[model samples]
Structures are given as structure tokens and as C-alpha cells.
Target: MVVWNNSDTMEPTFILRAFPGLEYVHSWLFIPFCLAYLLALSGNVTILSVIGTESSLHQPMYYFLSMLALTDLGMSLSTLPTMLAVLCLDAREIRASACYVQLFFIHTFTFLESSVLLAMAFDRFVAICHPLHYTTILTNSVTGKIGLACLLRSLGVVLPTPLLLRHYRYCHVNVLSHAFCLHQDVLKLSCSDARINSVYGLCIIIATVGMDSAFILLSYVLILKAVLGIASREERLKALNTCVSHICVVLIFFVPVIGVSMVHRFGKHLSPVVHILMADIYLLLPPVLNPIVYSVRTKQIRLGIVHKFGLRRRL
Candidate 1:
């Protein structure tokens, strides 16, 4: 009923489907995706530039924001080429090596985002709960160390994924469900037993994102407690106000992730486009929305942007 090819002899190309039932309008789909890419790239780049140039913003919180911007930039660049090829030129065949590379970056930045968000929550916790010690606690060296640790943690965990995936021989339908490669999507197309991949993938999510989310929640709970302890309502609101952007970033990042997971697990009977769009949203939404949320919610960041772009007089 089935066959598996040897790893060495397998053809290493996959067809990336854009919209399963809406292929006729593939030409038109290019415009929105192109605009999304442009927005994600420009927004994240502007945030990074503003943070880098604004001396007053060079603190732990902004450092974490810079990390978030860098992560979004990485995600945008990771998918941009293949997405453009698929949507614009109708070029969908991605080689296995290339696919694995893309998968690595996509997943790496995903975990990096989780780690950075956790770090940001901790930054907030310290800034709110112990304002006197915030500077000494999260000094420049300490922030740099934390950023390095996040990068190392993400890389150390994700490095084995593509290697393990490469060992599996893919001999069945090589059509990918989305325009980009994902571990789960690619693994499903393999003819070999992928219990190891599946289990490892699950474990990594639980260990990384799961643990990070729990810690973030604990940080917020402590933040809430700190805010409530303030004597005045105005003080409480001011303390909580600083967390709005991080909370928004966290929601946008996690909501679509949960949506994608739910769709993959329970939406088997639904249209393929639903799955594709969910996955696309999960990948694209955070990067496109993070800078917008920050720019809108954080006054310091807004001022930094204005000063960096010489827009104060214009406005």
C-alpha cells in the first residue's frame, strides 16, 4: 500500500501550494502578501533604527524591544524570498535542502521570539516591582548576556531538527500545505516513521514556549500585585500602563500560534485554505503588528521614531 525511498536516492523538491481551491487568483494574491512583507520589514527596521539611535531609549526594556524587532526581521527575511517566488512568479518547487534551511530559520525565530518575550516580561517585572534596583539588576552587560542566552538557547534546541528531518526519506506526495516550509508540514509528507520528530517537536514546544509562557504569566501576576499595592489609583494605572504593549505583543504572538495548532489538530474536515491562512497568519501577524502596537502604545518609542526620522516639525 506504500513505499519509502532511500534517503540518498530521493528527489528533494516540494510543491508549495498557495490557495488550494483558489489557484485561479494566485496572480492577485501577490499584492496583499507583498504589502504585508513590506510592512513587516519596514516597521521592524524602523523600530530597530529608532532604538539604536535614541540614546535615551538604551535601557533593558528597549534592548528587549530591539531583540523583538530583530526576531521579526529575521522571520520576515526567512520567508520573503520563497513567499515572493510562490506568490509572484508561481515558482513553488523548493528543494529539500532549501526547505530545511527555511524551516530552521522560521522555527528558530519562533523560539527566539518566545524567549525574548519572556525576557521582556521579566524586564517589566523588575522595572515595576523594584524600580530602585532595575538599573543595577539589568545593566547593559546583564541585558547583553540575557540576549545572548536567548539566542543560544533557541539555536541549541532547534539545531537538531533539520538534521533529524534530513535522515527521514520522503517518498510520497511532496506537496507542502503552505507557501513556506514547516517542521510538521514537511514531516507529514515523509514516508518513514517520524515518531521521533513528532515527539521531539512536542517536547521542544512544551519545554520552551510552554515554560516561557508560564513564567511570563507569573511575572504578570507579580506585576499586578505590585500595581495593586500602590497607594493611589493613578500610580496603579501608571504602573500597569507600561505593560500594555508587551501584553499586546504577547497576545498577537500566541493567539495565532494557538489557532494554527488547533486548526492542525482538529480541522481536518475544514477547507485547506483555512489551514493555509491560519498558518500564514501565525507567521505573518506578529511581525507585522508588533512594531505598530509598540509605536502606538509607547510614547518614548513614538518620540524616538519622530526624532530619528526628523518628523517632529512635520507633525
Candidate 2:
């Protein structure tokens, strides 16, 4: 039997486990995690700098790319400190208020990434299907508004999560499943009825991830329809080629998300290591891969990077 504590009298700190059952190798695990963080940071920052400095990349697609880069940076920064502490130093205790704050940023940025990906999909749709009106449709003013809307929507939906969790009393087990705090992970530790939290969480996931993914797919369908209508096969391939990077990014973001959700819902009987590995992959893979995908696939970005490093002359 488990005992519940009163919210008013409960301790303020919660322990975070890097891997609850597999703690012996946590120090060893820090090497790859640290390398991933460094790569993600350097890759995203390079993309941002390249995009910002290159006047040619001032178009709508690159604007959305910059937004993606920013979200990746935020996602990486949000979890970096907690991850380092838990993996390297074994410092796992975090205050309730701090945990809530971290949870807010993590979820916000995650949703923000979804929103940005949807925006990028729209940008691709406009570029491929209606090339002439792309500028008019996604003007600087309009792009700014869309970016603001994404940020605002993410914040509005995630803002209530921490507040709701703060009211729930946690029982004996306050150890989180991962190095960082996630809304779902934190909610599970609460002893009180968390139907509200769970319901809200499901609703937000459906509203943002579900809705954005559906629309992104719709956009791609329209893009495919447009591409197929082209008279030349070469032109059709060329048109589809532009979307390969975005498609890879969408898969990188959503596949892990779906896997994590599935694991949470149905993998309870599985090892704790499976859950931890899935969660870490969901959080870490996008930031690390998004810039790499874009840098390799987009010519302008590649040239910009080359020019930035004075490698153009060498090549």
C-alpha cells in the first residue's frame, strides 16, 4: 500500500533518476549525452548564424528554418543543466517550483517545434504549389505574426500544466523517470487525483501535435498533387526534392513522439531502461538532426556555411 502526502506539508524537492534501475552506468552514459548536447548546440547555432548573415536566405523558407533552429536551441538549453547534473554529478534533487518551471519550458518548446514544423510545411506548400504568390502569402509581417501565434499558442496551452501540478500532493515516490522533468512524468508522481492534468495533457497533445501533423500531411498531399501535374518528370522530381529535408525532419520529430506516447501507454510491463531510452531519444534526436538535415539538403544553407568558414575559396 502507498501513502499520500498533503500538498501543504509536502517536501519541496524531488529526485530525478537518470535511469532508475540502471544507475551504475550513468557516469559512463554521460559521454554520449554530452557529445549529443555539444553537437546539437553547435549545429543549431551555426545554422542560425548562417541564415542570419546570408542576405539570400531572407526568404520565407529560411525564415521558417530560423524559427526551427530557435526552437531546437530552446529545447536543448531547457534540459541541458538537469541532464548534466543527473548524469555527471548525480545531483538529482530539484525544488517543486523549479521542476514546474523546467517542465513548462520543455513542453512549450516541444510544442513550439511542432508549430514551427507545421509552418515550414506550409512554406513548402506555398513554394511548390503557388510559387508566384509565396512572397505575398507569407510576407515578413505575416511570418512574424505566425511565429508569434505559435509561441503564444504553445505558452497558453502549457501554462496551466505546472500550476495544476503544483496543487497535487506527491506521494512517497518523487523520483522522475528521466534526467529532466516532463509534464507526464511529473504528473505520475502526484498522489492526488490527476484526471484534470491527464485530460488537459491529452487535449493539448491532440490539439497541437495531432492537429499540426494532420495539416502538415494535408499540405504535403496538395504539394504532391501539384508536383504530379507537372508536364516534365524531371521537374516533378526537382519539386519533390525540395521537400526531402522537411519530410525527414517531420519524421525525426513525430516518429519518436509517437513511439514515446506508445511506450507510456502500453509499455508499462517493459524495462525502465526502454522507457528512459525512448524519452531521451524523443527529446534529443530532433535538435541534433534538424540542422544536419537542413545543412546537407539545402544548397543556400550549404553555401552560406561554406562562405562563413572561408571554405568557398578552398573548394
Candidate 3:
């Protein structure tokens, strides 16, 4: 969600330099970000720990389930430091190479998270949509393979970005305008033409996040058709209920990400600060909100947490 400031193109500085000074964010921003960063980490960790500590959760479903939680934790943690710095200090400053590196890993994790979610959606589709073959189809071997594939898919596609960026020699206007180094922002800083980076970046998006999202949507579409055909009213209600939480999660991920990207790309001149704020909000929203949505809507998860934590059942 970082904005690329091309206004400094005329400046006699290194073309590919990072922000020299930190733009200290206001206290208000810091307070929320501090809480959000902590919550995102804590919530995801709690889920991962729950799955790890409880023997009952050692099944294939929970393995992928825990993986998703772990991916979320990593994704959020990757972005939080810079975001928090943006919130806490008036000036946001990071080294050029470090900024780009941070950005690369951030995108890498983001891609991994999307892929994991797609796998989880497939798990749900198998369990609910094809109950008979669920165990056979989603065995330990299969889950492991899928997990490895997700990792490789993300790394394979996104690895080229940093490599490409490194090749481009940054020559004036070294300082980045945004708080974090984004590919687009970094590309914008390049004095040289960046057609290759742009093409690769787009391809990476299509391969990683875009492909994962398409599969997730397809899984749901099949899920919807399958659930709607159930004869019993109670059964239909139950099926719908099962998907409600995930639907919310998908919305949370799809809406803000696409929205912020749209705004950042087209709405650049409208309000750069708003652009920055939207990017921050979009990036953090899913991590902060996913646990809340799931807990509130999914009784099993909520009760599992309580049971695992030794809490009394509540009405």
C-alpha cells in the first residue's frame, strides 16, 4: 500500500534510494497498530499452539488448518514492523535494500497465505461436498504434498522479483515516498525502464494470489451447488452455517486487497496519505479480523479454544 512518489524525479539523488528520513506517524496511529500487530500475532499463535498441543487435532484437516494460521502469523509479522514504525514515528525510514527485501518477503508470505487458504477450502469441499472419499482423498500424504506445493508455488513465482530488482541499477531520487518498499513503488523509483519487472510482477500475481483465489472461488462454487442440493432443511442450514465463517474470511481478503490496489493504482493523485492509510488498513485487516470473525461465527473453534484453555463454558 506504499505510494511511489515520482514528484522527486528531478532531484539529483540516487534513482533507486530509499526514504532517507523517517516520517513519524501520529500517536493515534501507533496505538491502533500496536494493538493490531499484537493481536494478529497472538491470535494466530494461539490457534497454531492449540493445534500443536492437542493430540485430537493431529489429523490432516488440522495440519492444513494450523498451516494456515502459521502463514497468517508470518504474513502479518512481516509487514507489522514497518507499519508500526509508520504509525509510531512521524518519519518512516528504512534502508533501500532492506526496504525492497522486506517488501519481497511480505509478498512472498502473502502469496503463501492465499495458497494455504485455497488448500483449506479444498479440504472443506472434500469433507462436506464429498464425504465418502474425504479420508482417502485428503490423506496425510496428499496434505503434505499440497503443503509443499503451496510453498514451492509461492517461492518459485515470487523469487524472480528480487532478482530482477537487483539487476536494475538505481541512478537520482533515491528516497522512496512510501513507508514500505513495494514493487510498484520501487519500480517507480527506477530511472531505467522496468518493463521486465512489471511483466514478471503481473505474472507472479496471477500465479500466486490470483490462481489461489480462483481455486478458492471454484471450491466455494462447487460447495454451494453441493450444499444447496441437500434434501433436509436442517442439513441445508448446517451446511450453510459451516461455510458462513469462510465466506466472511474470503470477503475480508478479497475486498480490501483489490480495493486498496485499485485505489493505489488509479487514485494516486487524489490523496497520497489516504492511499497510504488504505494500504495499511487493507494489509492488516485480514490478520486482525479473521480470528474475530471465525470465533464469533464458528462455535467449534470458540468452544475448542475455551476447552483447550480450561475455561468454563459460557452461554
Candidate 4:
């Protein structure tokens, strides 16, 4: 097992373990890791730039896309330094303070993403269910308020985690299973009683992500009812098609999160490698895939991307 570089002091340090039994191949792992990281960064930046430049894309739905892209960028960058350092340079040690900061950004971005998805679902709901009132309901000022509310909600929920964690004492070897710090992973290393931390964490997840997901489902349910009321089959298909990209984004974000939760809850018998890999997927996959999904599924985004890349004439 990897060991911590320092003793368990007031300000402890933790070692970030990459794939177990693959230390010799750690350097080689950088190739795929860097590629994925770069892909995530470039993809999200392209999404943001396209949305910014395309005047026609300045509506509520695209505004929400920009928010998601920004969240992805924040998430990807949060894990980049430690991941690269651990994989390429064998610099596995991280101070508790820095770890807490990373944990803050990761969780904050995660909750923010969930909230943004909920907002997008509302966008779809308005567009399909109340077509005549969509513009009236989701004006530029209203959308900005919605985005600000999401940010404040995520911040309010996650700001206390690090402070709460500071009260716990670490007696276990402070080696994290993954390259980056997570709230649960950090909580596991606490020697002090952490029932409160665990409970608080669970409660916030249930309140924020859990509730957001439920509301998103409710919105879609209402949207389906609205769509089915449409007399024309073609019109129904068109309305449903508008939601495909958001649905795909939701799945990619939540499925891996569910996988990670299940692994933590029931997969104690599994290898540490399983936990680490699952965490990485939960962190990296959505950012890398969200832009690709939107670019392919939403014609406006696809056209913007093609024009930005100067591929409009060729393709």
C-alpha cells in the first residue's frame, strides 16, 4: 500500500495512489490521461465559444449549455494537477488544506451541474409545454437569475464540508484510493468520530442532487404528457427530439455517480482498483462527453461547431 509522506499532524498530508500494482506503468498512463483531460478542456471551451459567438444561440437552452460547459471545465481543471502529478511525476503527496480545496471545487461543480441540468429540463418543459409563453417565461434576466441561484445553492451546500472535515483527526494512513480527493474518500481516513460528517454529506446529497433529480423527472413527466396531447405525430416527434440532448447529458452525469455510490455501499469486496477507476469515470466522463453529445444531437450546436472549425464548406 502507498504510504503518506508525513505524520498525522494537525495539518496532515495524503498520498494519492494511482492504479494499484501498476506503479511501473504509471508513466505510460499519462498518455491516455492527458488525452482525456485535453479533450475535456478543448471540448468544453469549444462549446462555450460557439455559444458565445453564435447570436442565434443566445436563448435559455444554450445559456444552460454554457453553464454545463463551464461546470465541466471547472471539474476537469480541479483534478488535473494532482492527477497529472501522480501519474507522470510520481508526486503523490497533497496537503490536507489543498485536498480540502479540491474536494470543495469537485463537489461544488457536481452539485452545480445537477442544478444546471434541472434548469435545462425546465427550459425544455417550457418550450414544449408552453410554446407561446416560453420566451415570456424564460427571458434573459430570468435565465441569469436561474443560473445565479444554481451557483449560490451549490456553494451554500458544499462550503461547510471542508470546515467540518477540518474538525476530524486522521489516524489512518492518509493514502487516497484515487488521484484526487473526494468527500467520502477523505472521510474514510478520519480517526475521529465522523458520524456527523457522514450524515451531513448524505443529507446534502439527498437534498441537492437527489431532489434535483426527482424534480427533473417530474418536469419530464409533465413534458411527456404535454407532448402526447399534440395531434400530429411529426410534431410530437419534433418536440421529443428537442429533449434528446438534455436526456443524454443527464444520463452521462448521473449514471457514473450512481455507479460510484453503489460501489461504495456494496462493493467492499471489490478491489481498490475498481473504486479508483469508477471515481475517475464519474469525474471525467461527463465533461469529455457532454460537448460531443450536444454537438452531435443539437443541430444548432453542430452547425456552430462546424462553422467554428472551418468545416462548414467541406461537410
Candidate 5:
């Protein structure tokens, strides 16, 4: 089992165990990861640059896309570097402090990304449900505030998590279930009682992701109702088409976020390798897929990307 480097106190509050057969699986996983990492970065940067340079894209929808790209970049950075190191540099077992910081930012960025998605959903809701009033509803100042809210909301939820994690004392059993220092995984290593940690984690999930999902559903509910009343079949179909992309994004993100949380809490006996791999998938999957989804599903972003990349003759 991999051990934390913080052995100065002779008692570890954080436990991380080395798993068998991980090196093999770990080695093979990075191949796709490298490709995914490059693609995600390229796609996000292309979006940002294209939107920034093009005056026509200075609108609410593209503004949200720019923020999405930025958040995706952050999401990728949070896990990929350390992940790549683990595979390539033979570096395993991070320091407890390092682990806590990683936990904080990883949670923060993911939370922020979720908020960005929620904002995008609202954008579509307004644009489709009230086309004439879309600009007035989703103005530049409002978009900027929404972007800032993503950061604030993430930090607000994340700040308490590490503080809660720290109160526990490590007496015995410091082996973490997975590679990176995940909250629940790290909680499992605590020699002291972790009831509060578990409760707080659940509360945060309910408060943040659960809260966001609820609002998203409500937004779409209103959107659907409004669309249904519309006389133009073409307009209704167009609105629904826009929603399809957002729906795919929501499923891709929330499923794994909630899934990893459940597996960590309930399925303790699952292979450590599986635990690590799945957790990584949760972290990386959204980033890897975000750009692809946007490029293919979002016409504006796809045009922006193709034009900026000089892939074909400029129209």
C-alpha cells in the first residue's frame, strides 16, 4: 500500500493503501488520457481565443461558452498533471497537506464547472422560452456576475470540507481506497470517528449539486411549458434541439459525480484499482467530453472552432 509522506508524528490520520494490478491498468489508461488531455486543452483554448477575437461572439451564449471553456481547463488541470505523474514518473503516495489542497481545488473546480453548466442551461431556457427578451434577460453584466458566482459558490462549499477533514485524528488504518486523496476515501483512513465528515459531505452534495440539479430541472420545466405553448413547430423543435446538448452534458457530469460518491461510501470492498480508475473517470470524463459535445452539438462554437483552426476555406 502507498503511504503518505507525513510520518513525522508516527501516527497517520490519513490512510492510503497500495493496490495490486494497478500499475498495469494505470499504464494503459494514460494513453487515452494523453489524447483526451490534449484535445480538451486544444478545444477550450480555441473557443476562448475565437470568442475573444471575434466581435460578433460578444454575446450571452458565447460568454457562457467562454466561461465553460475556462472551467473545463481548470477541471482538466486539477487531476491530469498528478495523474500523468503517477503513470509516468512512478510517483505514488502524496503528502497529506498536498492531498488536502488537491481535494479542495478538485472539489472547487468541479463545483464551479457544475455552476457554469447551470448558467448555460438558464441561458438556453431564456433564449428559447423568450426569444425576444433573451438579450435583456442575459446581459453582459448578468453573465459576468454569473461567472463570478460560480467561483464564489464553489469556494463557499469547499472551504468547510477540508476543515472538517482535519478535525479527525489518525490512530490506525491510513490506507486510502484510491490513488488520489478523495474526501470519502481519505475519510475512510481516519482513526477517529468520521460521522461529521460523512454528514457534511452529504450535506454539501445536497446543497450544491443537488441544489443545482433542482434549479436546472425547474428551469427546463418552465422552458418546456413555454415551448409547448408556442405556435411555431419549427421554433419548438429548435428549442428542444438546443436542450439535447445540455441534457447530454448534465448526464455526463452528475452521474459520475454522484456515482463516485455513492461507491466510495457504500462499496468499500471493491478493488482499490477499480476505485482509483473510476474516481479518475469522474474527474476527467467531463473535461474530455465537454469540448467534443460543444463542438458537435453547439453550432456557434463549432463554427468558431473550425474558422479559428483554419480547417477549411473561410466563408
Candidate 6:
């Protein structure tokens, strides 16, 4: 029942809600949100700097880590402007074109992160399971190709979403669920028939996130099998330890994603706060926690950090 007045000159502007039902508390939430942005920015930048400057750490693992840091940085930056505008300036208005641009980058970086994580999992599998052939398998050229492939795949898939949205004339209130533009959130506001959008969205999720998660799980299963074959308990522990940081990050990324997906599909009658919180967690937590997890769990990264900050002992 969409009232389609398709005029090219009449572009709709969207109102971004900081937190739909919790507008009164947005001021209080701003402090933590700002702090999280700062921490995520500083932490991921630090990881990149440490990896970039340290020659000893220029391996396939650190290369993938750098890619993860880049994605985290992109993800944080994609939402920072609108988030601040909504919370601080109360500037909730965003034009359709700008909104689509933001949506493209946010979704692009999101899928890119998943792709990088899958690449890292494969890196780990090779490092642990095929130690003798690790270098031959993940050479710098191959690694670059992998990174480029991830970027190209993400861009190609996400680019169509905004184009598809552009054709639809929106006649609803245009109130966004969170501080930023999301595909599903915006689609719901369209008065036009959205079956194609919905189906394409689901297809992207299944093709990208779903496939990546399944492959990551498969890589770990194979990794575990290889680890068990090691005769020495100490060797087995060392082998499994390498995957701990990646596992932590995977959980941080996927758990919130699952929560957001579930809420989107099943929790329509639920409070807006639940939906907002899940989106925030999915968008914010990985950037904030990924560096911390890597620094704490990866000894080389920890040492690189200490040395970078001149905190390493002279002894």
C-alpha cells in the first residue's frame, strides 16, 4: 500500500534516532559512546602502528591483523559522525543520498571484517596444520590477492543495495532505528514493496556472513584435529593458544550479529531499546575489543606494544 510519488527532485530526508525510546538518556549515553570511539580508534591505530613498524612481526598473521585493524577503524569512522550529530547537536536529519552513502560504507566494512576474519582463520589453519608449507601457501602476493578479493567481493555485493533502495520512493516517516543508516532498518520504512530488498539482504547475509562463519568453524575443526595429533601436551597447548585471540574476536563479532539478526526477524513486538542495543553491540564491540584481545593474548603483539611505548624492560 505504498503511495509512490516518484519524483527525482523530491528526495526524502531521514531522521536518525540516537536511541528511539531512550532519548532522555542520550546525553548520559554520549559520554560512554565517545569514550568507546576514542578507545577503539587509539587501540586499533596502535595495533597498526606496532605491526607496521616492527620488522620482526611482518608475517602473514600480523598482515591479517593489520587488515582487521583497518576494518575496525573503518567501521568506527562510518558511524561516528551521525552518532555525534544525533547525540550532541541533535541534528537528526540526513538526506537520502547521504544516507545511502553511509549505509554502503558501513555495510561494506562490516562484510569486509568478516572476510578478514575468515582469511585470518585460514592463516591460522595453515600456520598450525601445515607448518612446513605455511610460507609457500600464504606468500605476500597471495595475501595481497586475498585482501583485494575480500574488498572487491564486499564492494560488489554492497554496491547494489543502495542502488536498489534509490529506486524505491519512500512515503513513510523515515525514522531510522539507530544513530546510523542500516539496510533492514531503512527498508522497513519504505512504503514500496520491499520483497526484493528483503530477499537480497537475506541472500547477502547468507552468502557472506553465513558462508564465512561456516568456513571459519570448519577451519577450527581442522585445526583442532591437527592439534590433537601432536604427541606432546605442551606442543598441543601451544598450537591451540595461537587461535585464542582470533576465537575471541570471532565471538565478539558474530554473537552480536546473531543477536541483531534474531531481533530483526523475531522481536518486532519488543522494545526499541533491545534492537538499538543489539545494533550498537554489533557495530561497536569489535572495534573496541579486537585490539585489546589481540594485545592480551598475542605475546609478540604485547611485546611490540611495550617496545613501541618504551615500556620494555632493559634487563
Alpha carbon lDDT of each predicted model: 0.91, 0.91, 0.74, 0.93, 0.78, 0.92
Off by over 4 Å in 1: 1-7, 313-315
Give the Cα RMSD of candidate 3: 4.5
Which residue pairs clash in candidate 6? none
Over the stretch 1-315, how does candidate 1's per-residue lDDT look in tens digits?
A: 123344577656888878877878888998999999999999999999998888998888999999999999999888889888888888888888999999999999999999999999999999999999999999999999999999999998899989998888887768888889999999998878999989999999999999999999999999998899999999899999999999999999988988988988999999999999998898899999999999989999889888877785543
lDDT (10s digit) by residue, model 3, range 1-315: 233334433322222211222233355656777888899888888777777777777777678867777777877877766666655654455655676677788787778878878888988899889989998999989999999998898888777787777656566445554556677777766777889999888887887778878989899889889988999989988877877777787788778879887996799677566776677676788888877776678565676788788988683
Evaluated at residue 51, the lDDT of candidate 6 is 99
The TM-score measured for candidate 6 stands at 0.96
Please list all clashing residue pairs in model 4, or write none if there are none: none
Best model per lDDT: 4
By lDDT, highest first, what's the ranking? 4, 6, 2, 1, 5, 3
Model 2: pairs clashing at backbone N, Cα or C within 3 Å: none
Global lDDT for candidate 1? 0.91
Clashes of 1: 0
C-alpha TM-score for every candidate: 0.96, 0.96, 0.87, 0.96, 0.89, 0.96
Scored against the true structure, residue 188 in model 5 reaches a CA lDDT of: 70
lDDT of 4 by residue, 22-116 (tens): 99999999999999999999999999999999999999999999999999999999999999999999898888899999999999999999999
At residue 203, what lDDT does model 6 achieve? 98
Name model 4 segments beyond 4 Å from true. Answer: 1-10
Q: Per-residue lDDT of 1-315 in model 2, one digit per residue for the tens?
A: 123355577655778888776678889999999999999999999999998999999987888899999999999999999998998998888888999999999999999999999999999998999999888999999999999999999999999999998888886567777889999888888878999899999999999999999999999999999998999999999999999999999999999999998998999999998998898899999999999999889988989999998884532
Runs of candidate 6 exceeding 4 Å displacement: 1-8, 312-315
Candidate 2: residue 250 Cα off by (Å): 0.3
Error of 1 at 220 (Å): 0.5
- Residue 198's lDDT within candidate 3 is 94
Can you tell me which runs of candidate 3 are displaced by over 4 Å?
1-25, 89-91
